[model samples]
Target: MRNSLRFKVALFFSVLTIALLLAQALGVRALAEAQEERLIAALIRDDMTNVLKGYQANPALLPPFDVRMNGYVSGADRESVALPATVRNLPFGTHEIIIDEREIHVAIAPMGTAGTARLYRVYDFNIYEKHFKEVINALMGGTGIFALLTIWLSFGLSGLLVRQVAGLARQVKTLRLGESAPIQPGKYDETELAGLVEAFNDYHQRMAGMIAREKAFTGNVSHELRTPLTTIKTSCELLEQDAAIRGKSRARLQQIERAADNMRELANALLMLAREDSACEVEPVAMAKMIETALTPFADRLAQKGLQTTIDIDGDLHVMANRPALAIVLSNLVDNAVRHTDRGGLHFRYAEGWLSIEDTGPGIPAHAIPHVFDRFYQAGSPDASPAGVGIGLSIVRKLCERYGWPIEIGSEPGQGTRVSLRLPAASRT
Candidate 1:
């Protein structure tokens, strides 16, 4: 029963009431007894002296038989106590007697002859006893009623306080992490509880800001994709209008084919971003060995452009990654580096779980650096003579982000550029 708050509160107040009532009861009993004793002593002593003085002044006015003066005495059964041989009357030393058939304290003394000059002192406690009993009954009843009222109020007040706290806690439990919830106000005083409620409202507003940013990121990507798609569709329609399949005009058809391929590649890159949870199968690939294999396809182009290639690859550095993803990312970076370099030389390094592509090329401009990662955003205009879609960095960014690897881009315009890839160091189970 003590586990419940109402029971505990009620018990506490009940115990407090009992203690106060007990102290009051003891004080009342002692005070009533003392006051009665003092009152009885004063009345009995004064009467004993006065009656003895009256008897001393008149000696012949006494009765022969022993009797109570001016009043008849009675026993406990409301009958008369037999008069003794001597009138052991009032004013005697403290003793017992019958008065009105009730036994009571009495004292007697004589001032003149044996029968005359008598006096009495009486301390009958009957009246005080009756008065004390009535007071006891009234006090016990009043104290009991007060104790009951206090217990009821304690349970009601404490239960109300506990109920409000429990309700607020249940509501807080329903709130979700990273998601905002509507605040339902609970019963509370205009105190510390108000501050806590305002804090929750502030947190809900901050969550709204994060939700808005995620929405904007998605909207921007969709707007960027629309432009390149329209350009590819128009170029394809232009090629289909002509019927000649031979001569220098064939390059027009080839250009259309290349644009279509580029658009398909860009679409696939966007698909990769959309499906980040798509799992890919993997196997070991030696860095120095795979770069040698991949660079073979671009050799002819390098030769035609009167360019030189330098490969300074260390021993076989094994890395685990999806072959297709690594091929697209590495090929795109290398191709872009080679295309933009006027010196026509490509350099490579494979060291410490990383592969770097460095080219002796006129590097990217400084002002365009920040926007390089934006989709379909190419750096340098026709004046600096840079080519290709601006999405190579976007692909690299998405692939590196999805794979949880690190990518670094560093360039000095008119000097050279370096693109570094750091693969995740695999953990052993």
Candidate 2:
């Protein structure tokens, strides 16, 4: 909770408000105490003056005041007239004293023409002390109530602010890689929040435009290149049929044909990948035919390396998928297998909705296996063959991810590598 911005903002304001309240309470209590003291002193002096005048006129007529106050007259033969030693010898002035564990405020003045006669008026200090305490308690109680209200208000306001920020964050997170639509500006009363939403909307528009342009360019280039590639492939096939071409020259023409076929497959894959949607028609595809078509372009390479190929799938087994997309996936996988194996055989198997390709080549190192599907990541060492640009496996991984298929690769140092592509149950059906 402490990491949350709303919590921090509320806490900050709450502490500040409490501190201010405490300071104000202390200042007000001090001022009240000073005023109370002055008022008590004035009342005491006035009462003493009135009693002295009445005593001079008729001493018996001046009855005792409230029990909280007492009047003492020196030279009078009365118990109340006998003052404590602490105040008995004091001069005519106001004094504070404690007698019999009771605090008193005293006012002394001359009583009569006799030099020895004097008046002492005393007021109980407990009354003023109790009232001051009550005032302070009330102030503190009010401060506490106000503090709670302030904290609640702070949390409410901060929540409103943080909610706007969180909404913006969620919108940005939902902007996927292929999303072409721009984000809409959110409605907010706060100027800063509205400005932030506006800025994000602008950025979203620019990014969407850039992605659309990139996809268009890729599609156009791939489409334009396909016509010429088909022409070259057809010309190469025609030349291969000529009786005059033979030996090394015929092999060169065959290589050109294989290269052209690979190029066409790559172009088709690029066009499919560049499209924003995967709405191609799904149809039942024969596993045997798919494998045969994928392997045709690699026949020259497999023959050159003397690598034996094996297929262990039922002839009637079929998978449901978009034909062109699945073609790219299978071709890339086959091409990767053919490029790596220098000797021994390549094997394919289908069981339990999984299609696996096993190759008996120098196995990928354990450290390199994790990054083998990354774009342009060479598995072991630099290959002298021009075929290993390291993007075939990456494209295969991308297609599998798009179709929600799980792909796994297992390899040991000296033993060979096996790649398994787990198809959906619906695909197998």
Compared with the true structure, all predictions reach lDDT values of 0.66, 0.77
**Candidate 2 vs. true structure, TM-score:** 0.57
Q: What does candidate 1 score on TM?
A: 0.41
TM-scores of the candidates are: 0.41, 0.57
Give candidate 1 misplaced runs (Cα > 4 Å).
Answer: 1-247, 250-257, 279-282, 292-297, 382-386, 424-429
Q: Could you give candidate 2's per-residue lDDT for residues 50-111 as a string of tens digits?
A: 76778889867644432222334332213343347556668788888876776667777765
In model 2, what are the clashing residue pairs, if there are any?
none
Candidate topping TM-score: 2
Candidate 2 residue 301 C-alpha distance from true site, Å:
4.4
Q: Which candidate ranks first by lDDT, i.e. highest?
A: 2
Q: Which ten residues in a row have the lowest lDDT in candidate 2?
A: 68-77
Q: What does the lDDT read for residue 253 in candidate 2?
A: 90
